[model samples]
Target: MRAHADAFIAYATDPDPRVRRASIEGLGLFLEDAERAVGLLQERLVHESGVAERVLVVQTMADLVLRLPAAAAPARAWFDALADSGSTDADTRLAALAHRARCAPDSIDDRTVPVVIELLRRVTPAPPPEQDPAPDDRRPSRCVHVRPRRRAIRLFPGTSPQHSTTSNATAGSMPPTPLLKALHEALGARFDDRKALLTEQLRSADRATRYDAIDMARRLIASWRGDHTDLAVHSPM
Candidate 1:
């Protein structure tokens, strides 16, 4: 696989979605080379033929971010753009919601909270029996031939009509149960003095200040996670 990496990397842009997806999945095996690997994978997000393929590009990028956190700012920005995109569809809004939350947590109180609540109401325990078996998009997989059917035309809660457009493209709904569970957990999670601390995370320009703010938040998430970007990526980079 190491010897053939160049060929496989080239295949990430292949005309076939299957090849593109497999190539992205294969790229995951080379996270140690963060600069080259992330550079290669970043372009694929735009070139991917479909959302499912794009998400693989993302997931693989995420794995790389675990190795090179400096690469995260751009990816985080991309997810927020996807979420806040006025021209993007509700499915995109739905897909980008959690990620946007991760990227721009400040929006949770102002914008995303309402959008998520509304999305929760429309969500079914399953993907409606009919849509249950549709091809999964957010995860990379071997089954790339199947096409996704358009799901419901969900709302983007607070988007003033001018800021949002309805996405009519056919795509399967993300499984609702896990989504609901995650949201519920988020809702239930405890936070002490979030306003003061989160404001610092969002405002401070100093990398160290931002790092400290984020580390405080992580201490809340789990003590074992370690320093984020300001601390730098682990492993041989």
Candidate 2:
């Protein structure tokens, strides 16, 4: 395996795309060869240009960095390039930056968050206004029983706060702690309170508040439905 490791690294930089692709595929078989695998992939990233191919390389590089922290430096420049302002493809840039942020080294400063949020804003498509239900005469309910309505109804799904991620105050990867749970719940409630306060501001004649509300609504919808096809299909108002 050691003898062929060098050979694989050579093939990884082959001029033929097929050989390069095969080298990437073969690297997956050797988890014990992190140095060799990453070295080979890093070489390919220099010349890789196809959108789809670069995406795959980025994903694979993320996995490598997370699994082999020692190899992170090699990927740092690539991630910086991906998150650059000149990046045109929002999806690629966002995915690359998010993966790097999640797998960053302990000493690494967290600057990728805003870049990711911006990329998310750029990639998210706007939601169209809800359609009015058909009139009673033209109703298509259950095929023949459906009815139409004159008014359009947009349904907003309420947030469910019961779920918790690892970083959430309530539940963490370690043992359950009462103090942590209390803090988490308090923070969640506080967030709800702040949102209500903004709502009240919007209710008044505050023009800025109204604009902020509009922006927040768009972002909330985008975050909730970004990766969810089901929500897109059944957005009940």
Candidate 3:
């Protein structure tokens, strides 16, 4: 356990996106030492680039707070400052607001309300128009048709399809981003209203909205029963 935790801490900054994500999720194992985990995550946030990584770190901190409030005081303070800081990037601030809303609603008021409202209103930009295909690309090429002869099939009398496989176990799994995971943990079992809202967002035409909705749903279901066992098993790694 110690070795794995150490490896995850090192891989937090790994160049590969999958590795980084797995490492971030693995940090949840340190929930028993919230201060240490939160502090490490905060440090990673400062150095982390990319939207996904930032979102995950913020969500993980929120999850820590929700699961271990007494031990997550430092994490709460960190979010408070991040949300209020003018120099922080817009996305990070948005994540901070979302985390606070999920884990500590009372902390949100007039000052943060407008910010959250604005973030929810933000939209992804439309993609640029594609160039028309060249004239030669307009039609399919003509080819001679030939029917191939069928080969004899061999029957394994005792064998059927391998229906019982690990593939089936993973079919319904959708790993949530860090932010979504935190929201799920924080919301606990009372997420009907939030679930409905996220479902609406899932149907949105905007790519960003859809992405957020999917991530949120993944986490919501993962922590639905307030059991972190499965979530831990499928952590980013």
Candidate 4:
């Protein structure tokens, strides 16, 4: 597999949905083999029409960019391309925006935050209208693929009860859950200086501020656990 980049490349053109999906799956496996996975994903972002495939590509490429910064350069164009594509579906665009929010938080400043925030708000759990029919008390359906806890272990470890609880709630919801997305924004804002910001927030002047930050931190940790647990339960072995 180490020397089989071409083998993985074959799936890039496969027509069958399952075959295409497997080919997309192979890209991740071949990340080590395919030095050009980043480039390949960038190209796919423009031409690929499948929502699930686009989401997977965006998510995988986002992780790859973060892990291999040198490989991340080409992804910036993908982000811009996705953002500019009026033809792309809302969910796919939103997923791309979410990745952009992670990959280039600063790039989404005054001009874009409002749009992203609006999208987030629209997708957020809505309080029922007064005249609406009573709904089930059960938790809502969540995004299907949340990566896993292994991916989030370093960024969000369940160090407190609050963290554990939040993690569960995040995992129980469908993909693009606002809480998970909010945490991503919050953490992205801090970037490499996260630890310092966490420490500062934990020691903030206002008691309310400290509590709020702590609460958010807990939720983040819990979300990571939820993602990990969900993957373990549903993943094909």
Candidate 5:
């Protein structure tokens, strides 16, 4: 196991995507030593730039938690830090959100809520570029309409989170647009105050802020039962 783990760590940043992917898959063999495996994946995440490779590592951590819930604290802590770090990339942050939703929803706290909201507001796809009409020659040129395809929803399915190099891991479906579904799951029912805070952010002039506000408001409304009586009433409120 040590030899295999060492080899996986060495190849994790291989120039060839295939080699890197193979190394990511091979890391699954070390789940018996989940703390060590989690550490290795965390290291890879810090340096790995390819979206597919990062997704594989994040999903593998989720698998480890699923298989050995008792051993998940290290992995959960890693994700919590990643999700909260402002310097983290959007892809990594999104993966951390999804992993928390899947493996450690109860661990998501007030600190993570604001970070999730900020990330939701910032990650938007740019508009497609307009094309020039073909020059000269002919009858009126017809406009061709191309509809964007809906992304397929794929969940991490393996019990052990380990799969072959060709595993169909995708970053696209990692909490798609809106982001509230994953956030709702991660925040659970103990975040009424945070939900109210996001409600205020809904009134922002910024388009992304308003968009995230609506999604978060919808999530809170859909699940809200009553006020959190355990929370102290502040004088400002």
Candidate 6:
């Protein structure tokens, strides 16, 4: 990987937007030199014209902060800034939360849990009825049930989080989002307070809150048993 570091750096500014974003995503994986990698990401953030690269930069920075203890403070500050900013795009804004979850889980309190839980809720338009129109004037057909009006419904699909390499938060990796991963960290080791906060979330009357909390626990236990294959959260839409 080190041998191709220079190529990846150069490709970060490729003329093709797709190549540029792909290279940016690839650069985050090369963790040989943390500071240098971060510097390059910052530079790319300025030069990039599209939201995709910017989102990549933000997500990569979060991954860096998570892996390299030295990448905190500055990176965390940037995440907080973006998260708080009204102008921030949805993916970058959500990616910002990853820094809080992974690098500063202890900072998460009751106020923070609601925001994180909010991330798990997916706002999707309700689907049309699975049943088709009845043959006659709807003569008491079992299939002719009351279809939900065409309106948006909230799904607790664990709001927009992504794997480090995934550029799109809304449409990310098979693994649970960064939020889920952060909750995984909370279950043991350094985040006792975070664990307590999440434990409280499990009892919330709101089904979305409880579902996300349970999913977090599910991911935590799966990781403990060395079971990565079962971490995918199927959306109950």
TM-scores for the candidates? 0.46, 0.43, 0.54, 0.50, 0.53, 0.55
Clashes of each: 3, 11, 2, 10, 0, 3
- Give Cα distance to truth, residue 176, candidate 5, Å: 3.9
Q: In terms of TM-score, how similar is model 6 to the real structure?
A: 0.55
In the range 1-237, model 4's lDDT, one tens digit per residue, is 747757767876677755765666456555662348877776766667765566667766766666667665677777777766777665566677767767666665544544544443433334345575457745677759886452221112112343322211122222343223433564554432333333443443333334344545554445543223322232223
Candidate 5 stretches greater than 4 Å from native: 1-13, 109-117, 128-237
Which whole-number lDDT from 0 to 100 does residue 19 have in model 3? 83
Model 3, total clashes: 2
lDDT of 2 at 79: 71
Per-residue error at 79 for model 4, in Å? 0.7
User: What is the RMSD, in Å, between candidate 3 and the native fold over all Cα?
Assistant: 13.4
**lDDT, candidate 3, residue 44?**
86
Q: Mind giving the per-residue lDDT tens digits that candidate 6 earns over 1-237? A: 767888888888889977886677666676567778778877787776565567668767767776776777777777777767667555455556655665676655555545554543331112244687667866764666687453223221223333231212233322223444554564354344345445544543334444455666564554455423222233222
Worst 10 residues of 6 by lDDT: 165-174
Off by more than 4 A, model 6: 31-33, 46-54, 118-137, 140-179, 183-237
Model 1 agreement with the true structure over 1-237: per-residue lDDT tens digits: 866778778887788876776678667565456567766776776555465665455556545555566666765666677667766544445555654444334446545555654443333222223444455654666856766454343333222445332232224433322222233334333232233333433333323223334434444446334233332321111
Q: What ranges in model 3 sit over 4 Å off?
A: 1-3, 126-237
Write the number of the candidate with greater lDDT, choosing between 1 and 2: 1
Better of 4 and 5 by lDDT: 5
User: How would the candidate models be sorted by lDDT, starting from the highest?
Assistant: 5, 3, 6, 4, 1, 2
lDDT, candidate 5, 1-237, per-residue tens = 755567776786788977887767666655467777777778887777765567678777776777766658888778777777788777678778767776776666666666655554444333246577657654685898888453333333232223111111233423233234445555565566455445535533333334434545655655676653322232112
Candidate 2, residues 1-237, lDDT tens digits: the string is 645656666776778866766665444344456676676666665577654445456556766776767667767666777667474466456545655654563322334334433443343333355687657756454646556442222111111234221111111111111111222223232333323322332332323223333434344445443333332233322
Candidate closest to the true structure, highest TM-score: 6
Query: Which residue pairs collide, candidate 6?
Result: 119-159, 120-158, 120-159
lDDT of each: 0.48, 0.45, 0.58, 0.52, 0.58, 0.55
lDDT of 3 by residue, 1-237 (tens): 644677778888788976887778667655366667887888989887765677678877776776777645787788889888888766677678778878786664545545643444332223356799999899987887888443222211111334111110011121222333344445454555445445544544444345445556676666565443433343232
Clashing pairs in 4: 141-174, 142-173, 142-174, 142-175, 143-174, 143-175, 149-228, 163-218, 167-222, 167-223
Worst 10 residues of 4 by lDDT: 150-159
